[model samples]
Target: MSNREGEGKLIQVKGLIKKYGKLTAVNGVNFTVNKGEIFGLLGPNGAGKTTTIEMLVGLRKPDEGSATLGGYDVVTDVGKMKEVMGVQLQATSLFELLTVEELIEMYGSFYKKQVDIEHLIESMMLLEKKSDRVKNLSGGQKQRLAIALALVHDPDVVFLDEPTTGLDPQARRVLWDIILKLKEDGKTIVLTTHYMDEAHVLCDRIAIIDQGEIIALDTPEKLVKLLHSDNAIEFRVIEGELNWNELPNVTKVTKKSNYIYIYSSNLQETLSHLLFICKEKSIIFQDLHIRAATLEDVFISLTGRRLREE
Candidate 1:
């Protein structure tokens, strides 16, 4: 597939590939992140999101293709990576013995260009905990601090790999605000997240990767627009097996365990037909629900599996 039209492109990746012995972990992937925009890699776990980020950040050398961040060739300009971007991995080993302010200062000391420490602490919502030890901070606090360290040097680009993976909704929102503020402050961001809702809300454009290949790439609205169905009528079958796809006006159907989801082109007509069929067949169904098609539905249409499905 062709890449997006180039305009304000901060990062360009062409035919990027990676291999692990006999396994090709990342296929010939291609995409570009626009300047000051939030570009996301949206996929399930082990879908090569982390591998792509590693190669872009210069932690791992790509076996093929090239990527450029801030006009610096990611392949040949390994030493200049730190000058252009800041990264927060899935897990960061913080100096547990040190206080939050100390850790922030330590990271800033590594770079000649540094943002104000007070502002960094306040912005990450760690102002109250600045004097607290890293070991004493909560799980959410540690994650915030990790990101704070990433921003201390105030690089033009930021890379976050599943930043809100294990956080609660509230903590997740806090992190989300930080990300949004980064964009508002004219910073480019490359984020990798598996949560469809998160990607929908936070990303300007998402590249949906699976099995090391990008299956889809577009804004959240455009990706959802790709779905053939406008509405989804979801329910659970209490008993009996039926050909759900045979239902009228159904663009697609997916059944997981007892739950069946019918993606319908015409919602009211399809719903009426569904009820008629269930009654005629004497099929028991419960928890009937109807909603608009979303990113998960888009993934289902493309891959025939749920976003978080293993």
Candidate 2:
């Protein structure tokens, strides 16, 4: 589904901060999310992505700063804010004995306006498991059910924290389709994820957080373009290491273990020079791979650490 462009901002966050004793969970952070857009919070664990979401959703009061959702201040109008927003937390606890349809109905009872039970089920692709008990459903099915409950109230904005963390590739793609469908229906989405590829595929714009602060925010393509090189050539050297900076068109070089990575804009020149150098030096290069630079590389470049690493 195509995104709704030119939509006005639906969420505003300013100087958002949350503290726990001597430690700060979220430092001064700010960003806005437009209506009918998918805004992603991408960061490693304990980077405060969840804290920021909690502050925006009224689950946690910030030590400093403020946020507003759907024109209502999260602090001053938390009840009103809750009416317009739905949340699927990182760890969702559900009634194990309840059937899927019953669970949806139970959550819908909390809202004044409720969506059709059958339609919500089908929308989440849980029609086949509608009558099954929560405990009997697979991990993917349970995750979909949790999302279904979040939408039963027909919220204007939805918050998903690590929605596809543990799902397999196929199941993750299914959830991606469902999320895109929601965007097509004009619902604003705010998501936090550890998966760089997921953020690249799903988010209209991403805010990269690290050490309790937002380090960068932009569209996926724009973020990746921030790097000097757009392509990466990687291989392992068995004989000896050569000065990577001497390679033609090489912008940056990173070496981890036995593998060396060269980032370059001119892939053809870089590949040709690398091959020539390998032949001249009699360096036995193994497992050669060349691919486009990605958000993962961007994160590593920015933080000097991988997304999953502490």
Candidate 3:
């Protein structure tokens, strides 16, 4: 599904702030979500992604600033806001004794209008486990069920916080597909995750938050392009280390253990110079690998830290 013309903004946040005593969790952050677009809050733990989501979803009132969803103020029109939004937090608690279908029905009953239970089950890929007890489901299945509950009311906007956090590779991919389907169905999705690849693949635009502030906001490709280096070369030396900064066309160099990472805008020049230097110095590099710069590299370049580190 696509956003209709003239219906641009679905969610608007301006100077939103949330403080816990002296420590501010969200500090004067501002952004807008276009209708039917997948917007992401990409940050590490304690970066205030959850805090911002809570404030926008009306679970917690912002200490300062304001926000609106679907033309209704989050603070003043919370009752109406709740009716149109669905939220699946990082940790969701469900009755362990309830069957999957029963749990979906229970959540659906809370709304005046509900979607069909079977459709929700099939859409979430939980048909085989529909009659299974909540406790008997796999980690991915449980997460899917939680999302199904959130969509039971056929909400226009969905807020998912780290929806695939603890799942394995297969499960993570499954959830990715489901999220894409939601976007195809024209649901505006707000996702918060530390996984760079997830944000790169799923988000139409991403806001990179760190230490309670938005440091960068753009499409994933544009964000990566901001680094000015499209290629990354990584390798480990057998004995001694060389200063990679002297290399031609190399933009940045970072070293961890015996391994070195070089970012370059011109891949051919950087690789040719590096090969010449290695041969001249008789240095043997091991485990050499080269690939395109990614969202993780962009984050590190901006913050001087990894996404999962701090």
| Cα lDDT over the full model 3 | 0.91
Evaluate model 1: give its TM-score: 0.93
**lDDT tens string, model 1, 1-310?**
0243333777999999999998898999999998889999999998999999999999999999999887778878777768768999997899999999999999999998999999999999999999999999988899999899889988888999999999999999988998999899988999999999899999999999999999999999999878677788888888866666657888878767667778888999888878888888888889999999899988877887888975
By TM-score, the best candidate is 1
* Residue-level lDDT tens digits of model 3 in 144-206: 999999999999999999999999999999999999999999899999999999999999999
Cα lDDT, model 1, residue 62: 95
Candidate lDDT scores, in order, read 0.89, 0.89, 0.91
Where does model 3 exceed 4 Å of error? 1-7, 236-245, 254-259, 279-287
Q: Over 4 Å off in model 2, which ranges?
A: 1-7, 237-239, 256-259, 282-286
Better of 1 and 3 by lDDT: 3
Clashes of 2: 0
Residue 50 lDDT in model 1?
A: 98
Question: For every candidate structure, what is the RMSD over all alpha carbons to the true structure, in angstroms?
Answer: 3.4, 3.4, 2.8
| Candidate 3 to truth, TM | 0.92
Number of the predicted model whose lDDT against the real structure is largest: 3
Cand. 2 Cα-lDDT: 0.89
